[model samples]
Target: MMESYLELKKRHQKEVNEFPFGFAFSPAQFVEMMRKWGLDYEKDINKIVSIGNGGYVQKKDRDNMHEMFSRHRKEIRDFISADESGEEFVYKMFLREMRNYGYGWTGDPKDTLEALGLTWEDVQNNEKLLNGFNKASEVALRKVI
Candidate 1:
């Protein structure tokens, strides 16, 4: 059986409340967390939870995940913007790509760039468009957190 949101939350209570920091879970770590949560990842590789990979998640869970991310949009954006590596723009672009696909990272961010008739250079040159992309990546990001 699939794990419920409550169970996921209860299991990773610390990570959930202090997301994007403190423990600082990576996307890969997120998948591993789900695996440890009781999902048969090895037996059902197709149903594995991963960002930018064709992993299957139940519609109800997807909806809930979307809602949660929507609620924390500002916080997520702020956190990414706070990066000091001077690569915050690229990070934002990645999130923008995720936003293009129901706020989920179903594939490479470059795919979204292509879909929009853009090249990486185009994105690099267009600050306004990048700012316009909705900050929705927190959907897939904060899934287990």
Candidate 2:
């Protein structure tokens, strides 16, 4: 009585392909949009896509941040290495301000800090930390912000 996943997927694809208005989306995207917002596939496509405008932009921004970070990862890390807490500051800033800028935080504070390859006392009295961080931020977020 119930369709298999493949059958349902095929049907959804067919529906998405046949829909004639607004924008076009793949079946998987359509299904994800529907599932994320709790809507029916037949009736809610346009509504969800319309409401998804902000989500789409957010996704694009997040993706761009990731790409930029990846491209400049070594430079960012090198700059943040100026201070023991440099990486931590960036991590927390991303969490609070950027929300999903994708700065590669490990979720564990100790591990994240340790990844910086600095000891606790290594940063004591270090004065170039802020300058390094500023340069790093400029490099890392040049395209993002």
Candidate 3:
């Protein structure tokens, strides 16, 4: 009974896909949610669209989606606290996403990294983005001193 993100967005007239501070929901989060809802992650991926945008979910799945969001709120909150810098959080999540789901960016998808205003090279060479990546990495590695 999870609602498609688009449905929820239209209903609320707000963007609810990303965490309030930064970071999109992690793939692990989505996998856990699917498990909770007794959904097959592989077979039911279409049920999720906000991950990278596009598509819609069946109205029947609305309640389950709401339940998942309600339960996962804490995880998002934790991510905000840990990320500190919103852009770093967003980059880390986006990198995780790119690794988990092949972007298939060849089709000119509207939601590809390039379409989203970034690139792997940008992360590597752009001073601002690279610094964010380095900071996030240091935190991930527990190298903060």
- Taking every candidate in turn, the Cα RMSD to the unseen true structure, in Å, is 15.6, 17.9, 14.9
Candidate 2 residue lDDT tens string, 51-124:
24333322223454445445444544443453355445343332232223333332222332344444434434
**Which rank order by lDDT, best down to worst?**
3, 1, 2
Candidate 3 lDDT tens digits, 13-119: 34345322112266776566667656677997665444234223434555655666664554433443455454555445544434333433322222435533556
- Where model 2 places Cα greater than 4 Å from the true spot, the runs are 1-25, 50-130, 133-145
Poorest 10 consecutive residues of model 3 by lDDT? 15-24
Model 1 stretches with alpha carbons more than 4 Å out: 1-103, 134-145
**lDDT of candidate 2?**
0.42
Q: lDDT: which candidate is best?
A: 3
Q: Per-residue CA lDDT of candidate 1, range 46-83, in tens?
A: 44333344343433355655566565444434433454
Ranking by TM-score: 3, 1, 2
TM-score of each: 0.25, 0.21, 0.26
Residues forming the 10-long window of minimal summed lDDT in candidate 1: 15-24
- Using alpha carbons, what is the TM-score of model 3? 0.26
